[model samples]
Target: MTESLTIVRDDLTGAATRGLIAAHLAGMLANTPVESVHALDLTELQHPSVRVYSAWVGGEIAAVGAFKTFDTDRAELKSMRVADAFLGRGWGRAMLGHLEREARDAGIRSLWLETGSGPDFVAARRLYESAGFSYCPPFGDYSLDPLSVFMTRDLDPASESAGR
Candidate 1:
């Protein structure tokens, strides 16, 4: 079935978003060590610098993603997740594309993110790679760590909007 997906800027404090954020966090905790689990909790997701997005299909959350601004041109991709029911259905990719467009709209020149370096994160890593993100050194407050894999992409506002 072809369902139209709606993307919205989510206020992570609400009940609908809170549940999804918690589920994403729980999945992160279950798969990685406490120290290596970098997924933001509900409170952190409420930070002023972060902007969260959710993809809704048929009135249900199919996927979610967020980005945190850093300086004027950089941002960190955060809290990306696809609901259990939406896995293998390209919802994650759709959510990611939405986030990228948002970043481009905001004049963000570079986008970076950190993900787990384990077998469980293989698919996530591939998703980033396919979306034009390349390996990079950790940014923001992150330090050199064996458990984290960092990736980045540079966006040009002029090029992205030229065709549109």
Candidate 2:
């Protein structure tokens, strides 16, 4: 099953991809306050600084993930979601790994992310933690928010703790 999962850069023009992003945003809004919802919408994901990717299993979109590059060596993970029909099959972790590799190859030395702090985000937080992300202060234009959890990880290949 894993071999069939092909992840590719998305142009954000497909109906399935757009629908999945919408669902991701809706889920974020439903689980967290509007002010704390940081999931990028379709237009935002298409920004020049942002790169979106979609994982396809067979003909259906299994998951979507993206990152927004900051200054030179930093990027923020955004819009990560596994389709409801594809959850619990390790697709989320696969997508996370895919994004990490893409960022690293693009010269990104640090990967940051913000997710909800409520129960709804436990799995997401855990997935990040297991992938070497550690809790950190908010980065970029973000600030401290009780409903948000900020995390970051070094992507430098020479760093001993790149993924630990």
The TM-score leader among the candidates is 2
Backbone clashes under 3 angstroms, per model: 0, 0
Q: How well is each residue in 44-126 modelled by candidate 1, as lDDT tens digits?
A: 87899899998889889888899999988899999999988889988888888888889888889889999999898999999
Best by lDDT: 2
lDDT of 2 at 133: 92
Which lDDT value does model 1 have at 37?
A: 84
Predicted candidate 2 versus true structure: per-residue lDDT over 94-113, tens digit per residue: 88888888888889999999
* Per-residue lDDT of 88 in model 1: 90
Q: What is the lDDT of candidate 1?
A: 0.87
Q: Which stretches of candidate 2 lie over 4 Å from their true place?
A: 1-3, 158-164
Q: How close is candidate 2 to the true structure, as a TM-score?
A: 0.94
Clashing pairs in 2: none
Candidate 1 local lDDT, residue 118 = 89
Q: List runs of model 1 lying over 4 Å from the truth.
A: 160-164
